[model samples]
Target: MDTDLTPLRDRIDAIDRQLLELLNQRARHAQDIGQHKHRAGQPVFRPEREREVIAKVLQANAGPLLSDGVTAIWREIMSACRALEARQQVAFLGPEGTYSEQAARQFFGSSCSFAACTDLDEVFRSQLSGSSAFAVVAIENSTEGAVARTLDLLLAHPVQICGEISLAIHHNLLRRHDGLDGVAAVLAHPQALAQCRQWLDKHLPGVERRAVSSNAEGARLAAHDASLAAIAGEQAASQYALQVAAPRIQDEAQNRTRFIVLGGQPTQPSGHDRTSLILAVPNRAGAVFGMLKPLAAHGVSMSRFESRPARSGAWEYFFYVDIEGHQDDARVARALDALRQSCAFFKNLGSYPIGRE
Candidate 1:
């Protein structure tokens, strides 16, 4: 029996073409809207509007792709349209192919222009000096805890936390050779090695761990030497043409690093937001509790609280807090006012949309 379905297949192909054409037409309309927004001095990224559009599309799309898939496709389309209107330049700590670079790409899609800085300080300077529109710097790691350098930079710099991205840390053991038995030395950034210490100790027991400036550098070194292995991300393995000897070799499977997007102005609150601030308190008992009491009174949750040694003064510390509301919120405003009365010095580090894992 000849089940001739050629006509139906042709119809399906024609429909696919029509769908693509309709998408292109929509994109053109988006471009026109972008021009109008630019003329009116309006921001290209209207998250609330985007959410509404996505919700409507998902509700209407009842066919081949799921709602989540439809949302994903539309988000990329929206991102492309926004890029055409305003080319956002992002800066991040890297020599390229670092986890920070990955986080930046995750936050701002791959189409966005990026400038990779050598250090966290450079990332801050790039945004503050307007060399880049925004910067991404790692604030905290799951295993290693908070990055003190980032804290210091936040205290010293005038930039605001406009957004945040959470990146999962998956350390891979890469080498030019296929097998791990031939690997004699391991190369990686100090932090990467520290995060995967237990795995390294058990798997490659006596191998020499050489600390480098960046994970990309480590991968490059491993690429150059057949016997050397590098502890880096899966992306680095392909970038440097190294084979993964051990995948996901980090000590913890749930390990994640949070990167903050720093810019000149505060970000518009996205409903789900977090505010960071620095406070210096006198060397006295209950000083910390006094500062936090207002938050409790105002029903604001504290997500993170850490203290760094104050650079200028002796025996005094600067407290860094991440609260669960925007600075513009009345509760947050009252908490800040009360906190000021208790602390010697206080600075709001700008609130932004919270990054979800």
Candidate 2:
């Protein structure tokens, strides 16, 4: 139990140093690869190559740490190397710190360049206006469902959905002190607060819930006053040096948010992909069902179906659908062709590989 462990500890430390040197060498090779890709006018991210590398690393890993640990470290390395070749620029809704920013960094890596916009519309505009090559915008949350603002933005913007990123949301009740009894006001982004409404109501019943721009902003505001509490992500609490009164305060145990990547052009089909489209149909009996029938007949599975109020029309709505299949596939093309004739207005929103995390 109390035996000497100095030799093993020293060996482990030596191995870690060697691992660091190997990582540095790998990064240098990655820089050369980036230069080659850039000279050839290729995109920095190659999903296929990444998948291959992850698989290889996972298979080769054999130690105290498992595949997950190795994959996690290598993923960050790949992202950093990719950024060095050409700074991968991503736009997101934020004021420097928000869930969108976190999701963007997780998806694009920390080394990539970032643009924080004031609103969801600005995120789309950044991509459309060529200010940023890609945009990351939240689409839905497990408890709150789809973000209405994001859906509306997609309807108005011509940018295409190129990929999807999912982030696990861990909300914490942060304050200047340890307890919630002395807290007078609770602050959080409107959406963040809404997601944890049930918990807040049960715990801090009479407290005033103030809406702020983001979770990080709420944490910053709470840090300034001992009587104020904030509901935010873990990163916010850490960044603002606030005390976490309650950890994992979200209503659902599996709280997660899905973000969509927006860009000017569609991605090439990577075998398994999802395509999104907006359709406006005549207000008639079985119109919605009729529109969906083509997809059903074509054996295409519908991943998401949402309806939003249509502009320039009286009491009309547009249906946004995410379906399984690439646009170039014969089955998808046939379904789109049939659906186009039944719908008044139809727009393809592009297709991309599905993200798993």
Candidate 3:
């Protein structure tokens, strides 16, 4: 029986045409805004504005499509519109197929090209050298407190945090064949290996585990060696042509990694925002209290706090603080001004939108 589709076909075709026209119209307006922004000396990408737009669309959503589905379609639309003005070049820690790359794409969309670096330092360097417009680096993992190297780099570099992304870490045990028998060693990034430690101990007990540069690299190596397995993600499995020997092998079911987009400029507050800082308290008595007192006084709340070795003098350390407001907020500004005096050293890492995928 032939379904009566004439009316539906006509409606779909008409809607498709209208959609194309609307997209182009939106692109034209975006280009005009880009020109205006250029004349006013504004950054091409505004994370806060993007977040606001996404939130608005999600709030307006009331149909068959979920929030993520709406976001996926709108991201490409915005990506293309942004490209009509300028396309971004992003750098990430990778040999390709790294979670860093995934985070970069999740934030930047498909309009941009990526510069894959061998190490995190290279990712930063790419941004500094103009090889990339932005750099995405993993700052912290839910399962592993924080990435110490990223924290140190944040202090050492002059780059600002323009945006951030949180990616759920689903570690997959990949293999050349379906069977795990005769597997000699498991290869993965050190962090990936650690995240899957308990699972490996229980399932692949007594097998030698080796650390590699990246999980994707481990997958690549595993693809070439039949006797080896790798702990990586789906991207790695596809990129290296490996099978999913086991899925979700991480110790924690709710593993997530937070990545920051570093650029030369900072983000403007979009109502909802976050600011990061690196500071050290004075050597005097009650110095820590002095450092934190202003935040309470100004009603500025803290979201995270971690300390790292100062690396210069013994017992001297730098505290990485994540506050729940933009640096420009009146109270936050007051808190920072008051707290500045309590520190032997201080650096404002950056402020960025709090909401992200």
lDDT of 1 by residue, 1-357 (tens): 235888888889999999889878887898999999779977666644565566678889878997657766876777777787787888987777889888887766666789988777888888888888889888889899888889999998777787787888999999887778877789887888999999989989998999887788889888888989998898888888888888999999999999998874556666778999999877888888887899999999999999999866577899999999988889988998999888898999888877646
- Provide the lowest-lDDT 10-residue window in model 1: 43-52
Best by TM-score: 3
Stretches of candidate 3 exceeding 4 Å from the true structure: 1-7
Q: Model 2, residue 347: displacement in angstroms?
A: 2.0
Candidate lDDT (C-alpha), each: 0.83, 0.84, 0.89
- Model 3 agreement with the true structure over 1-357: per-residue lDDT tens digits: 236888888899999999999999999999999999999999888888888888899999998998888997988888889888887799998878889988888888889888889988888889988899999999999998798888988889888888888999999999998967989999988888999999999999999999998888888889899999999899988888889988999999999999988994678789988999999976677888888899999999999999998887667879999999999999999999987877788899889998565
| Model 3: lDDT of residue 270 | 96
User: Looking at model 2, which ten-residue stretch has the lowest summed lDDT?
Assistant: 43-52
lDDT, residue 148, model 3: 81
Q: Report lDDT (Cα) of residue 250, candidate 1.
A: 92
Which candidate would rank higher by lDDT, 1 or 2?
A: 2
TM-score of 1: 0.88
